[model samples]
Target: METTTATPWLTEEQQRIWRSFLGGTTVLMDRLDRDLRAAHGLSMPEYEILVRLSEAPGRSIRMAELADAVAHSRSRVTHTIARLERENIVVRGQCSEDGRGVSAVLTDHGFSVLEAAAHTHVQGVHDYLIENADAQDFIAMGRIMQNVVEQLHGKNF
Candidate 1:
């Protein structure tokens, strides 16, 4: 004889937490994007790309690596890099190891731009998430998010 298991539904408390996470994340991201735009004339995605490039070795990374780092599609990364290139913030070069691979190098201007924008982004994060959250709760949230990321992304990455 075989037994069938029933699907479990979320409890009210679980549902509440899930909804709050969704809404809060949306609002937080929107606020951060708006703050970055108003302060530095950079969109959040562009800022993220610059940040990743700046942190990479030699202030450069392969376009595919950048897309993976930022969780964006290759096509989207290409478009954003093109926009940054036009602004003289970043330039693409043939990857030394593999000529077919493309690398995005952050220009001095790009580093300066990221430096100027970092403050606004940090403060927005603090204002929207950190300052408002309890210290213990925030740590717990971090752990929970790490678990989620590991469960969802660890295998693929």
Candidate 2:
């Protein structure tokens, strides 16, 4: 027979902090998404995809790799890319090195859109989170997030 230990509940302080973190993240993302959509007609996820592609060589990335970078499923990336393609922001191409692989190429129009939206996104980030936070606290928060990412990603607890 297998035995299992009961999980401990979060302490009061831990619960409070966790809830605050969750609420803050939701608010921050909502604000950023709203700002991006209002100002540049881009969703947060689309902006993220553009950022990733813009940073890639030749402003292109294999679709599977793009999906992984954004932490989205392949189907979601495909759907999003289809939307972007309709807007002339991105185009799909077969990877030269591998005929079976498809790549998302950021169009010139997409780069221009991203350039305009980047300013709003950066300002939103500063206004909502960075500007009000103490430098030491912000750095600590970043480190904490990094640790959480390392702990939760690609492994069982």
Candidate 3:
């Protein structure tokens, strides 16, 4: 039988900082997602999924690998892919090397959509994050996020 260890809870100050971080990130993400969707009909997660697939070799990647790249669960990726597939923006194909492996491919129409949407998304990013933040703070934030990502996945990107 496996025994579970109880972790210590956050102190008042720690909790405040944690909540602040969570709140800020949540609000920022919501705003960005809203902007992207309003302008391009793509949720942030869907946009990220599409972007990753677009950048992949031959505009295709294994479903599992794509899920990992975007930090999405396999199931969530599948559901989102189904939606994209219905839109004719993406297609699923069997891997030639491994019969069991599935790959997501971005269609030409999808690429066109992404190219148009990226402009608006970048403008939204500039308005929400870049325009307001101090240069040093922006740099610091990138470093902090990079470190957190590295610690979590430890993958060379």
Candidate 4:
């Protein structure tokens, strides 16, 4: 004989909020990606990777670190980097310090592309979310998402 535990479920309000979050995020991400693609020929993930490289010291970072920074899998980052390399946006080279690690370096062209794309991305973010959301609600949403990220990642993200 086995004992069974009852499954916990969300309350009606909780379920409604969760569904809203899911739908809203899906639409928001799609719009952002579409805008970037239309204006810059860049996908959201690629834009994120370029942003990470741009912020790193020397505009370069180890491939593993880049993947981690973007919260993407190593293989996914590798594939994206490959595409960027083909476009002459990024180049991969051995890390000078260790010589055993590979790093992705953003080319000057990549930076220029990013600069142009930033305007579109930022405006989309503002027009779709920030401008429409109440300031206090936006701040609270940020805090709530940060907490969720910390819980999931086991550290502040």
Candidate 5:
């Protein structure tokens, strides 16, 4: 014999809000990706990787750290870096300190591309999200998201 506990479920309002959040985020991300692809020939994930590398010291970061910073898997980051490498946008080289670890370095071409893409990305973000939401609401949403991130970071899931 087994004992079972009752499951706790969301209230109607909570369920509705949760669904709205899921749908809204999906649409927002898709639009952003599409906009970036159309304007810069770069996918959102690749653009994110470039942004991370550009911000790092000497515009470079170790492969593993880049994946972690972008919240992507190592293989995924490697694949994207490979594509960038083909386009002369990025290059992978030995880390100077260890000479054993690999790092992704953004090229001059990549920086120029990123500079152009930033305008498109910023405008899209402003048009799609910032302009629509009240300033206070946006700030509150950021706080809520930060709390959510903290909670998730504490758990395995």
Candidate 6:
């Protein structure tokens, strides 16, 4: 009998772990988004954008760069910036060096909102994820995620 050259699919245990990771990540992010939205009116993506901008130089970054850092599409970033601009939380400024380039700057009010939301967000993370998880488990999770993210996104994004 001829044997197959191609490798077979995941073993049952491998499948179980992979599926658990997928489903758990989905649920965790969903819960986080919901909690942040209810408590702070900020989506997870928006919160990430704010955090990145807050830590960047002058509390601002070019629009395209911001999108890259957040792993969002340029168009999606624009839409998000528009919404934030409307809320007066973030401001868009023309890049003096490049007229076509725009920068998203987090306003003082935006910083305030982020600071306030951070407390609730952290508590939510602690309640939903950290409180139930062991330190070793948490570290393992980070390492696993780091490996996955590096493998998947390091080259492309």
Model 5, residue 28: what's the lDDT?
A: 94
lDDT of 5 by residue, 1-157 (tens): 8879779899999999999899999999999999999999998999999999899889999998988787777899889999999999999999888867899999999999999999999999999999989999999999999998777743555
Give, for candidate 6, the lowest lDDT window spanning 10 residues. Answer: 148-157
lDDT of 1 by residue, 1-157 (tens): 8788889899999999899989998998999999999998899999999999999999999999999888888899999999999999999988987878999999999999999999999988888899999999999999998898778762565
- Summarize candidate 2's per-residue lDDT along 1-157 as a digit string, tens digits: 8778889899999999999999999999999999999999999999999999999999999999998888888899999999999999999998897879999999999999999999999999999999979999999999998998778765545
Q: Report clash pairs, candidate 6.
A: none
Q: What C-alpha lDDT do the candidate models reach, one value each?
A: 0.93, 0.95, 0.91, 0.94, 0.92, 0.91
Instruction: Give the clash count for each candidate.
Output: 0, 0, 0, 0, 0, 0
**Tens-digit per-residue lDDT, 1-157, candidate 6:** 9977898789999999999888988998999899889988999999999999899989999998998888888999999999999998899988888979999999999999999888878888988889978999999989988897778763664
* Best of the candidates, lDDT: 2
Model 2 alpha-carbon miss at residue 5, Å: 1.7
**Which ten residues in a row are the worst by lDDT in model 3?**
148-157
lDDT of 3: 0.91
TM-score, one value per model: 0.93, 0.93, 0.85, 0.92, 0.92, 0.89
Q: List ranges where model 4 is wrong by over 4 Å.
A: 1-5, 154-157
Off by over 4 Å in 1: 154-157
Candidate 6's TM-score reads: 0.89
Model 3, range 1-157, lDDT digits (tens) per residue? 9878879889999999799889978998999899888888999999999899889899999999998999988899999999999999999999998988999999999999899888878887898879988999999989988989889873555
For residue 36, give model 1's deviation from the true position in Å: 0.5
Q: After TM-score superposition, what is the CA distance of residue 18 in candidate 3 from its true location, in Å?
A: 3.6
Candidate 4 lDDT over 53-115, as tens digits, reads 999889999998998888888899999999999999999989888867899999999999999
C-alpha RMSD between model 4 and the true structure: 2.8
